[model samples]
Target chain A: MEERKVILDIHNFSIAFEQYENGFKKTSLPTIRELDVTIHEGEMVAVVGSSGSGKSLLAHGILGIQPYNATLGGEIIYDGEILTEERKAALRGNEIVLVPQSVAFLDPLMKIGPQIRKGKKDKASKEKLDGIFKGFHLKEEVQDLYPFEMSGGMNRRVLVSTAMMGNPRLVIADEPTPGLHMDMVRRVMAHFREMADNGAGVLLITHDLEQALEVADRVVVFYAGTTVEDADVKDFEKEENLRHPYSKALWRALPQNGFQFIDGTQPYVKDLPEGCPFGPRCKECTAECKKRIAYREVRGGRVRCIHAV
Target chain B: MRHHLLFIGKNLIRMILLLFGVSVAAFILVSVSPIDPLQANVGQAALGSMSVEQIEKLQDYWGVGQPPLQRFLAWASDFFRGDMGISLLYRQPVLEVIKVKLANSLWLMCIAWVISGVVGFVLGIISGLKKDTWIDKLIKGYSLLIASTPAFWLALVLLMVFAVWLKVLPIGLSVPIGMEASGVTIGDKIQHAILPALTLSITGISNITLHTREKMIDIMESDYVLFARARGESTWSIVKNHGLRNVILPALTLQFGSISEIFGGSVLVEQIFSYPGLGQAAVTAGTGSDVPLLLGITVISAAIVFGGNLIANVLYGIVDPRIRRGGKRS
Candidate 1:
């Protein structure tokens, strides 16, 4: 296979929040300890994780839009250069776009059209928005209505249209299909696939493995704020093909896979065990797993477990 | 547009009912008071020399001998016919006395309101944008001091410094004594109004500044604002377009609600400065038990309050599309 040009590369990224405890004593709570993700041009990578696995924080960190208290570590390289804060600010909403998770991101007092267009009132921008809105099955008059006047599903579609408005080289969509119906979900996934086909790297952050598998070329499994596996979408076809123990457990828990659940819940950030984050939950855990484990390549896929063959 | 018209009509009916209620309440309170209008019209020395028959005739003339309910009905009927009756203290038509004073009071109130609104809102935006900084802390401290200070005391302090100590401005009254009323220039009026206007504006400024800063900070933290920032919109544009638009509604509501405080402050400020405004006349009427003048002032104050709220509601409909459409839908 030919080497695809890398569009986004995030290596060993970590996020910690500084909070004041007991009036004046400051403490740092690490949320994402070590996360690594890479996307190539013309590729759609789906990041699959359960809630509080730091999926959305990864997206915000890449965009340099994290909350003020968060302290980010490690490097994020975009294109061929290191992505600095200034570069992120300059490229945001132009070369890079984010489809936020909540519909409340829409301004309640502003009309739908102006918000999606980012206040562009030109004829070409208007017509382009109309075309995107039409593809999403939104009416022409819907653009004139405020967000409070629209349904949750309609607002989600409007948010999707905002991403399509700009010619973004990278699109980060965070749980974009939650309130949408099955058909709308499919349509949105297809739209992201189309963007990927057009040379844009699409990062679809979601909790639905079935939905991610339907459209993504690659799947990155996240467990307790760290990447446990990075494999081709076809690896999810069977438990034997997957590389990590946590990934296999996730596949088994799917409805179509006999709905088998693993024992114990994902560890909270405060009480996280040392070494491998998934050590407490892994059935194959050993004394070696109590030490820091590194991500290693196995059969062209990456896994963070010492026992993975 | 029809919906807007209906809304206005509904508010107008409410205003009329409110005025009627205020009139009845004021009349009953004044009638039940131990202070007798007959004694007010005639001095205690004069009352001591008068015979019982003479006193009864004077009471009958002033309608104080009649029952409270009868007097209220009679006043309401005359009030509806545009007659405010006679002022026992000033011995002039109550309407005539109020008309001149109302104009002066409105001028002072408007000047104070505009100055406070502009200054408070601008300071609020600055403090909100620079939150947790020393500048923000300084403004907060100043607002706290002003809020806690008494309006009358502040007025007295200003009068002593600017009028007596500095000797750069006049001490009291709207117009200088011995000058033709028509000869009073705008500059002269402003000069005389400085201390009173400042006194009236301090409390309003404190309240509005605090309210506006809180609302602005809240809006800056809203999800929509963060979304706007993600769109690479300039900070100034976002603050002007999204931040100001959302904060103004609450700020305007606060401003309208402060109209009562403004009037209350005006009464004290006007009394200290003897500015010849309605507040001073109100004080005189209350002290002398001038029933007709007091009732007239109460009705007018009620009308002003009701009108201010109505204007605020209509403006809210114009500024917020949600209310505009929701009003129609309901």
Candidate 2:
């Protein structure tokens, strides 16, 4: 088969914030360190991490919407071109869309229609919006209502409709299904899957491993602000097939796989130890694991652990 | 339709009650004041030389011999019939004097109010959008300085500079000296009003500017604004679409609330300029103990302030859809 075009290739991505310490002392906190994710045309990639692991930061960093104090260190290659700040600005809403995490992201004072349309009043745009809203089961009268006047489910659908309004080639959904019921979660996931089926690159940043496995073709596991493994979804069928120790542990902790958990929590970014971030909690940790570990390929999958074969 | 009508009716009743309360308060306070309307209006020597019958006639004419409640009742009854009584000091009908004086003050006040609101709102938006920069710092410092400065002091300074030394504008009054109402030009009225109106405008700008600046800052930092930026909206577009709507409502509320402050400030400003506006007339009535004229001015000014607030409340419904849609939150 012919190789699919790489739509988004993010390598060694890291984000650090310039913060004030005690008495005006300045410090740089590396919240995301040496993360990597790549998605091909028509592929759905999920970056799965728990809260504070900086999964959302990756999405913001890719879109160039990081906080004012954040400093980025990485090369985000999109459609074979280096994604500069200007390029991100140019392609943000037209080519690359973000389905934000919450209903609060919608402007409270604005009407639903003009906001989704980004104030576009052309006939083609309006017609496209009508079709998209119809598909989402939103009525014509709903367009005139405010976001606060709608249910959470309706607002969630409205956010999804924003991505579809424009012919977006890359859709970055950041924790789009938190606090949602399983049925609603599946519905939102299917909308994203449809986007991918239409040949767009969809990057879904989620914390639920089961949800990620349900819709994503590939999963990148984040541990302590780093991607420890990048494996195919089929690799998660058994714990032994996973390359990284953390990914194996995650698979084993799934309800169908005995719900076993490892000891110790992920280290805070400020107190991360030398070498492997999971070293202190790994039963198979050796003195060699104290050195800086590099991400390398092992049996057609990427892993950060030296012991993985 | 019924909801709107009910809202208006409720506010109208409230306005009547408010005016009544204000009139009674002004009457009681003026009655207890030691100015002695008979002595203030007529000379002290004239009072002593008057015959007993003449003295009784003067007391009765001034309503000084009647009980406070009875006098108030008499005034209220006459006021309800559109009769504001006669000004003892001006020797004219109280309503007629107020109408003429109010016309003089209205233009001065309206000019000041418009200039302050427009200029302050634009400066506030610029300062907030350029927060933490030199422009923001400069506007903040200017607003603070103006807010702290006394209106009378500013008025005096402007008068000294423009009228005393510069000799560019008229020193006082609404028109050129010795000019008849028929002969006086609009240009002459404006020139005389410039100093007093400038004083009022300069002082009024600071409150709205600072308040709008604070609100704009809050809006710029909100999550929706951030999302707008992420949606590829230019900074100007975000402000036009999001920031303006959020901040304008609060600015309007502050704008109307400033009316009373403007009316109060006009009193001192008019006194300083000697301009024959309602504020100057109010001062003259108070010092001369023209009870009828003072009471008339009190009722009118109270109505204006209350009316401003009522208009603001009504406009809130038109401007904000959340309020307009009426109490249904999902």
Candidate 3:
């Protein structure tokens, strides 16, 4: 909230992509709609959303590597400076890094050693390479092994080591534990926590609510390309103060045996019901939800649905 | 070493069968020619002018009196024994005549292949990574135009523009062979090999280029590339470390069929340039109906195609681990 306090601030960020039709943009939705968020220095933010909710798309824009079709609006500020094209050039890989979903960060043909070497840092910085690999529970011999040799978890951890090797300020990890076993997920979450504790801002993007709750300090919920809620992880359990019905329903659907599952569906994008995108999915839905559109900040969080008191 | 040898041997057997099939097709087609080589040679050299004993002798010598299967078997048996008989035009052993020409052809083809394949693959990768970009669209259009069009015509156009119009190079017989054409130096031969080789390579290069680009696009857009990019890898590094490896494997498969690829399309390029290669020899023998010569060229070309496929199979194990020993064990 204060000047020079936030490390990364995305204000009114939206993305529309051009398609084959020439005159119109395509995809199920615009991806991100009026999404405002911030990351303080040395803070960890977790992005949790349904598939196609544009969490990845938002990351692409923030990283300034959105697919060629992406047309982004609004300003992204990093450490009190607005991120221009030139600023993004400096920010990439050096200031911020992303550990994508498992095994995606590797080159299939190349050995693991060179992959880490391909980072943005200088030669002397490369001496720390072996040390970093050791830290990730990998053998020093793995440096020469091709991606095909290592297990899936090994590949994901290798990318994480490469990410932190440069001493980057921010790390965005998308789907860190999608298909991993419970033990492996805990291991990766521990790695994220370790990085966050070491004073690097880590944004964990995933669909797993439990995984986010395990390691994330703060959580941002996305529904239908819009930010539905932003709240502290400590307060994620409070049901009444939760603003968006979509957000509340998501919390309900967590597979707790005693937890009551909310009966609501995520709104379909193209043929969406009018007004609040979550209206059709909300158990407390009414006709008035169609007419009102605004993000209301209540006690525990900020939510997009106007029905919240 | 044993593993490699065994793999090669299996592929070689498949190659032999393919070659045998192609040879049969060539033999049948040559046999069906409307103009008889004997007739074309001597206006129905019936040996009718000879006495009864002599006519029988001539028919026997030519193997015409034998049944078709017996004749074919005899021909095959003789071929295995390295006796290709004599060429009507050259008056030399067909094998001897072809050896020199095949060498020249192989040399030219090797050079052309090296240039075209490397260039095409590189361009394909670049074009593929940046698909729909100006460079990608340009390379795609250029490759499509080059590949769909004929190589011979393109050679002639290049020859006209680069040699005749510009006076940059010579017209024909640019290199001396067997001390025949003023004994030109190796440099001169290379200079001469340049134009003809270019003609032979353009379409192959273009075809390969286009195919590689298409493959690269698939590889680049894969979930893998996104993962690599997200790791803060530079665009160039991404292209090299990840994109190139994945994209180029399928293109490697393309080169496995390089045998049929070169000979099938190179016939016209050979004819246009008057390059004394297997293709040209085949054309001459086919036109003249010189059965033995035709058979030799047909078998050789078929063998080349066969070898190419064989090479492709072995290459599979090298490029993709899924096809290799470790993969099989799993």
Model 1, native contacts kept = 0.51
lDDT of each: 0.87, 0.90, 0.75
In the range B115-193, model 3's lDDT, one tens digit per residue, is 7789889999889878888999899998989878888789789889888999787675547545656567888888777
For A1-309, candidate 2 gives per-residue lDDT tens digits of 468999999988899998889959999999998898899999999999888899988888988888889999978999999999899999888789899888788888899999888777899889998999999899998899988788878978899998887679999999999899999999999999999999999999999999999999999999998999999999999888899889989898889989999988999999998999999999889999999899999877788999999
Preferred candidate (DockQ higher): 2 or 3 = 2
Give the clashing residue pairs of candidate 1, or none: none
Candidate order (TM-score):
1, 2, 3
Q: What TM value does the first chain of each candidate achieve?
A: 0.95, 0.97, 0.89
- Residue A78's lDDT within candidate 3 is 81
Q: Please list all clashing residue pairs in model 3, or write none if there are none.
A: none
Q: What would the DockQ be for model 2? A: 0.62
Model 1 gets an lDDT of: 0.87
Q: How close is candidate 1 to the true structure, as a TM-score?
A: 0.93
**Whose TM-score is higher: candidate 1's or candidate 3's?**
1
- Give the CA lDDT, 0 to 100, for residue B106 in model 3: 82
